[model samples]
Target: MGQVPDLPIRNFEVAGQGPAPPVILVRSMHNLLNDAAQRALRYLDELDARSVAPSAEAVAGLSRFQEPLPETSMEPRDVLALLDQIGSPATVATAGSRFFGFVTGGVLPATLAANWLAAAWDQNASMVVLSPVGAALEDVVLAWLRQLFHLPAGSGGALVTGGTMANFTGIAAARHALLNGVGWDVEAQGLFGAPPITVIVGEEVHVSMLKALGLAGLGRERVVRVPADSQGRMRADKLPKLAGPTLICTQAGNVNSGAFDPVGEICARAHEAGAWVHVDGAFGLWAAAARERKHLVEGVELADSWATDCHKWLNVPHDSGIALVRDEQHLVGAIRSTAAYLVHGEQREPHHHTPEASRRARGIEVWAALRSLGRSGLEDMIERTCRHASRFAQGLRAAGYEILNNVVLNQVLVSFGDDETTRRVIAAIQQDGTCWCGGTVWHGRAVMRISVSSWATRDEDVDRSLAAMIRCARSLGVVKNNS
Candidate 1:
């Protein structure tokens, strides 16, 4: 080998290199995080006192965020101040007790704390080698969920982003398993020449499930729609003969009516016909944890796969969903990845069970939620929320408003006189800002949907919200009395 000559050092003066620019010692990140924690606590402390809907001024102030990005970095404290001042007020206060627009659950304190700690850890829950704690927590949470939901022993599951992705994950597994059974390798060969799978869903199937089916290479429009009764339960008798690679997607919770399909019959028939069954139990599957409501989800254990949102009914922080499959190999086969650089551990690798390769350690919050709220506490929260929903239904019915659904769970649909009048009442209630509820058209009637999913929602909160709703309706002349 030839010897290389030493490189000469440049003698030219570098620009602005005088005195090495005194090493600036910035404050520790702990101070900034503490500042954020204080601000967050203050905001949460005032959540109940604030309006469920943002005021006109706060809505108008959203323009403050529209400015061009700054060229230079700003102090973290200043950035936090700006966000708390301008951004916080414009929020809809969905974490508060009175906001009932969607089936949104307020963050449990333990879950919130766990979320902060997990963010600080900054673990990428991709592989066990990447984050052993994340993977272990995920495995523990999955086992706890299976136990709580009475799922089959040794079932496989993944933590997903939310209900939509959860549904997508389970459906992806279903597609893989069904196709693979028919001598097709979906993951390897793609859906190009694969056998067409028959998808059956109720007429009132949620839009999220349909979107998930579409994302899984299954045509949404190709589904066979089973008729739903007045309460939105799928008529089991209406199910057509199942054959070939078939999938039956059943709903555990109807968004409008909070009704459950005849899942027992559906699963039995589908299983007998060698069909894969998946349940979209976004908010309703938690009913299995409640002793009084467990009957509503009877036979859910027989389903091949299930999807539900921990953020909705479990009262965890936003963006937590669970996808469960009876056969663990199916989920692994559908979503497992391979690379020479990747580490495969003896234990569970989180990414192999989910659709994402890299994701936050959401399982930490889920574990915190389950650990903090134990079995009885969780059951109480579910039962309490259902009671609140029933109270709302009773109050609205007493006030002469039409209760659209049987108060089966924590969802109530109410209508004023006519579509126009109901819409006006809904608008008036939102504008009044005492509490916030959303409008939805159910069965050709414009109705207000109240979803009582938050643990923070107390009986007094329900009464106050009911009073405000009735007052608004009376103000709009949609209701006969202020009662």
Candidate 2:
């Protein structure tokens, strides 16, 4: 095909007559930073007193950002002022004590402060040469995480954006190891004409797992589907007959019911049949860190690879996930990139272990999270949130409502009568704005999910949210007189 005709370039817009920003680095930087910090502290300080959800007027004020790009740069302090004034009002208080819409945690004070400091450092984190501290912190934290999760001493991992990328990274390594066993260099030759690898998953597998499989060029629908039990756990007995180049994907935590698959049983059976088992633990993986909750993930250590989110139960911050593999070489083999100009030092390059090269120093915040919490503090956070979930279930059941799940972890699924009534009650609760909890469909019926994943969520916050939920249900006729 011939090329299309060329078009004329548009003329540049006229520049505004305004003062240019300062070119020199000066002590005034601290003034701008102090102003921004004060604004952020004020916003956070008001979270408990204000409504959890933004008001309609606050959301509508987002239109202030719709104007055309400025021809001249505004002062940094002025820009920060506009952001705090207009942007802060429209944000959902996920960082507060009452946001239960998802299985994600509020940032710990240490991690949040580390994030701010790391942003100022502006480390690329691609290689040890570029950011030695960043790479060193990754090595140290990966070790700490391995011990925390009770993984094998030899296991290693890399940080990613979230659970989806974590799953993709682990699954990609599994693909590489499994396909390479039969003399197929899948990475070098591509999947074309490669050996067919059998993939298996349960009925209640999260969509993120399917997305990860699809991203790895493994057909999402091509895998065999196993049946799950009433609690949304994969029945190990129902696993299909395993044969040649097989990969079995298991869930450590069910998104809705908070039920964990029989990972130990499945691993034993899969290993006997010469198949690889991978766990998509996401948030539930953190249960291993709590002494009382470790039994829930008994066989989790036996998996070939695992994916989890530090942002969820670990209470670090948003967009922090990890992909750990028993053999570090497998992960490096799947994701490592090489270039003549790139620096290859004696130290392990952070980029070699994950799917990105040019990323922020995420490991810094994670290091701060672990260092500040230590072992006991983390365990306390996990156990405390789980107890809060049980409290929610108890309060709702006492009000003549149904508690669908067993309340095993930090998740609770409550059904306020029929599907229509459940949906209506959920809407009214959102409007009430006392707390934020999202709705989900569980096993076939509509239900609301209360995920107490944040370190900020206290016993009193749970009590307040429970009261609001019951009141909302009573308003919608789902409950009579809240009795």
Identify the candidate with maximal lDDT: 1
TM-score of each: 0.94, 0.94
Write model 2 residue lDDT over 394-453, tens digit each, in one string: 998998889999989999999888999999998888889999989999979999998999
lDDT of 1 by residue, 244-343 (tens): 9999999899988899988888899999999999999999999999999999999888999999999998989989999999999999999998999999
The CA lDDT at 336 in model 1 is 92
Give the lowest summed-lDDT range of ten residues in model 2: 1-10
TM-score of model 2 (CA atoms)? 0.94
- Candidate 2 Cα misplacement greater than 4 A, ranges: 1-24, 480-483
lDDT of 1: 0.90
